[model samples]
Target: KIQRQMGSSYHPEVTMKIQVPFEEFTLQIEGRADGVMETDEGTVIDEIKGVFKNLDAMKEPVQVHLAQAKCYAFIYGE
Candidate 1:
């Protein structure tokens, strides 16, 4: 859903897979971003999240989602 939105907005010229390592943890995070968007401002990373349930139930999960996006932001330097 979000990815689709980002894709529609960016229309990236290329798609790539990437893996990043977190030194603070002992796990290797892995996933593919939708694509990169090149703009006059800078490069942007697009992430997509889809929720299909009560909105109230999303509060707890939102934290984790934000954390993941933050990590991605840090790792990818977006």
Candidate 2:
């Protein structure tokens, strides 16, 4: 995937089927990031999205994308 290819520069790896336990139950979260990029600055979580329309049409979807990215960031501790 795009992330994997980009992460090759930083020797990135993928984490699959990550479980987050809560008080009531556990949430099963799955992700296949483009790749994890490590640099002198810090670790970067890459999320790739393909949209075939104007930004207006994609606003709602973009919000979802950002939410997913935020989750990924939280999971990765970035």
Write down the TM-score of every candidate: 0.48, 0.64
Per-residue CA lDDT of model 1 for 18-49, tens digit only, reads 45457865555555555567567987766677
lDDT of each: 0.61, 0.71
True lDDT of residue 11, candidate 2: 40
Q: Mind giving the per-residue lDDT tens digits that candidate 2 earns over 1-78?
A: 654656555444466356878999998997766667777798887777887788776536668889888887777773
Best by lDDT: 2
- Residue 16's lDDT within candidate 1 is 39
lDDT score of residue 67 within candidate 1: 79
